[model samples]
Target: MLGSLFQKFKDGLRKNTPTFQKFFGKVGGLFAAKLDAATIDELEEALFAADFGVETTEEILGEIRAAYRNNKDLRGQDAAKIGATVLSRVLEGAEGQFSPNPEHHPEVIALIGVNGAGKTTTAAKLAWRLQQEGQKVILGACDTFRAAANAQINTWAERLNVEIVSSQHGADSAAVAYDTLQAAKSRGYNVAILDTAGRLHTKGHLLEELKKLGRVVQKLDTSAPHHRWLVVDGSLGSNSIEQARVFHESFGLTGLVITKLDGTSRGGALVGIYRSLKLPVYFVGLGEKPEDLQPFSTTAYVEALFG
Candidate 1:
C-alpha cells in the first residue's frame, strides 16, 4: 500500500525530479573526481535552489562534510545515501499514522491554515479516508466567516454521506464548533473534523478567534481537538515554514498536511518545514482526488527526492 502511495507521490513530484537529478548529478561528479571546497559550494547552491531553507541546508552540508572527513574515499552515491539518512533523521519523532483513540470518543481534529490552503477540501478528503478505514466521521463547518464556506462543506458532507454541523454565514465560528462536538457526541461519531475559518496568521484578531474556537472545544472535553493540523500549500516553499511557525506558536500545531505538491518544484520545502518545526507530516496532497491525499512516509519522501 505504501509503495503504491509513494509512486503516486513520486509522480506528483515530477517537476522536482530534474532539480534533484542535477543536484545529485553535480555531487556525483564531485565524488567521481576529488571532493573539494568548490564541490561543497556547488552542492550548497543546489540545496538552496531546492528551497531546503538555510538551517536545514547547512545541516545537510555539515553532515556531508563530516562524512567526507571521516571517510576520505566517500563516493557520490555514498554522499547521496548520507544526505537521505540525514534528511530522515530530521523528520523522525512524530507518528505518521493517525487513528483515533477509541477511548477519546469523537476524536476532534481541528484543521487550521491561512486562506486558500485547501482546508475544506482536505477535511473532506480526510473524512473519506477515515471512512474507508471504517471509522464513523463527522465534519464541522466552523468556517462561517468565509463566504460559502458552510455551503462547500455541506456539499462535501452530502457527497461523502457524513453528518455535518454548520450555521448561517457570519455566525460565531466558536459556537459552530461547540455545537458540532455536541452533535458528534450525541451521534457517536468516532471522529469530528472541524473546518475552521482560514485566516492569515499575522492577523491578531483572527488568531484570537482561533484560540476561542479551541477554548470552546475544550469546554466539552479538555483533551479534545486531539489533533491540530495545519494545511499548508507546498508551492509556497519557504513561506510555508514561516506560516507553520506562526501557527505552531499560536495553536501548538500537532501535524501538517501539505497540499499542491503535484503542482510545484518547491517540494523540498517539506524537509525544511519538518526539520525546523519537528512536526509530523500526516498527509500530502498530490492531486485533487480523495485518494491523492496519501499518508506521509519518510522513506518514500526521501527516495522520491534523491531518486
Candidate 2:
C-alpha cells in the first residue's frame, strides 16, 4: 500500500525533486573529496532553494559538516544517507497516527484553513475515504460566511452520497456546527466532518469565530470535535509554517492536511512546517480526485523526499 502511495506521491512531486536532487548532485563530489567552506555554502543555498526552512536546513548542514570533519572519505550518496537520517530524526517528534476511536461515536473532525487552502474539498475527500472504509460519514457545511460555501459543500455531499447538515447563507456558523453535531448524534453517523469558513490567520475576529465553533461542539459532547485538522497549501512554502502556527495557537490543531503538492516545487516546505509546528500530518492532497488524498506516512514521505 505504502509503495504505491509513495509512487503517486513521487509522481506528484517530480517537479520539486529536480531542485532537491540538484543539491545532492552538486555535493555528490564533495563526499569523496575534502569538505570545504565553499562547498558547505553551496549546499546551504541549494537546501534553501529547495524550500527547506532556514532552521531545518541549518540543522542538516551542521550534521553534514560534523560528519565531514569526522571523516573526509564520505561519498555524496553517504552524505545523502546522513541527511535523510537527520531529517527523519527532526520529523520523528511530529509523527503521529490518526484513527477514529470507535468508542467515540460520530467522531467529529473540523477542517480549518485560509481561503483556497482546499478545506472544503479535503472534507469531502475525507468523508469519501471514511465511507470507503465502511464507516458512515456526514459533512457539516458550517462555512456560512463564504457566499457559496454551503452550496459547494452540498454539491460534494450529493457527489459523495453523504448526508450533510447546513444552514442558509448569513446564518451564524456556530449554530450550524452545533446543529451538525446534534444531528450526528441523533442520526448515528460514524463521523461528522465539519467544513468551516476559510479565514486568514491574521484576521483576529475570524479567529475568534473559529474558537466559538469549537466551544459549541464541546458543549454538545466534551470529547467531540475529536480532531482539529488544518488544511494548508503545500505551495505556500515557508509561509505555510506561519499559517500553521497561527491556526494551531487559535484552535490547538491536532493534525494537518497539506494540499496541492502536485503543482508546486515547494514540497520541501512540508519539512519546515512539521518541524516548526510539531503537529502530525494526517493527509496530503496529491490530486483533485477523492482517492488522491493519502494518509501521511513518515517512512514513505522521507523515502520520496530523498529518492
Candidate 3:
C-alpha cells in the first residue's frame, strides 16, 4: 500500500528535486553567455531570490567570482558548470544518515516534534525502515495526551505487525514509556521507537511531559532513548530554523527529520537549517506514507534540488 507509493515519491524526489531546477533556471541563461558584469548582477539576484539566505548566497557567489577570475576562458554553459560546482562544494559534507548503533540493541529513538510536524508518520516510517533492515522493533505510544496519538500509531503497528506498548488516553505518558522499554527489553526487540507527545517548545507543560518521558526511559537504561529526533515541516522556511533552535534548547535533540518536502516551495530552508544547526539530519519525509523517509545525503540533495 503505502510502501509501494512511497517508493514512487522518493523516485520522483530525485527526478524532480526543486533545488536543482531552481539553480539551473537562475544561472542557466546568465552563464549561457560570456562572463560579464551583467551576468554577475543577474546571478546575485538569483541567489537571493532562491532563499539561500544572505550570508550563504554571498559565500557561494564569492567562490564563483574567484573561480571565474582564475579562468578567463570559462563562458556560456561552462560558466554555469563552474558555478554549480562552487555551490555543491559549499554544500559538501552536509549530507548524512541517522543510524543508531545496535550495540544499544533495543536502542530507543524518541521522536519529538510539535503537532503537524509529521511526528506520528515519521515514527511509523522509521520503524518500517528498521524492520526492513532485519531489526526487531517495538513502538511505544507515549503521546497519550493527544486525541489521536494512540490511534495513529495503532494503524502503523498493525501495518508493520509489531508490538506496541500503550495505555488509555489521559494516562501518564512517562509510565507508558517506562513499560514500553521493559516490554521491548523482554521481547528482545532490536530497536524501540518511542512516539512522544507532539508539543511546541513554548508549551511549558507539554515540553515538560517530553522531558519526563526521557527521564523515565533513562532510568530504565541509562542511555535509553539514545537518540532524540526533532521533526520540522520543510515549508516553514525561516520559521523552521527558529523552531529547530527552540526545540534543540528544550529537548537536546540528537538529529532532525524535515517532512513535507514534496509540497513546499521553501525547500531552500533545508539549506538554511543545515547551515544554522549543523546537526545530523536523520531523515526527510516526502509524503504521507511510511517509506517516504530517506537518509540525508548532501551531494545528492544539492544535486536533486538544483536540477
TM-score on alpha carbons, each prediction: 0.88, 0.89, 0.84
As a TM-score, model 2 comes out at: 0.89
Clashing pairs in 3: 19-305, 19-306, 20-305, 20-306, 20-307, 21-306, 21-307, 95-298, 106-190
Q: Pick the candidate with the highest lDDT.
A: 1
Give one digit per residue, the lDDT tens place, for model 3 in 201-287: 457787788888888888889887888888888766657788788778988888888888765555656777877887777787877
Off by over 4 Å in 2: 8-14, 24-39, 200-202
* Residue lDDT tens for model 1, 102-133: 98878999999988898999999999999999
Model 3's number of clashes is 9
Answer with 1 or 3, whichever has the higher TM-score.
Answer: 1
Q: Write the per-residue lDDT of candidate 2 for residues 1-307, one digit (tens) a residue.
A: 6657666555555455554555454444443455466767777776787687888888888888888788776555666677789788888856567667888767899999998999999999999998999888888899998768889989988998989999999899989989888887898987999999886345897799899998889898888789999999988877878878888997899889988876666777898888888888899888888887888877887777665
Worst 10 residues of 2 by lDDT: 25-34
Q: If ranked by lDDT, best first, what sequence of candidates would result?
A: 1, 2, 3
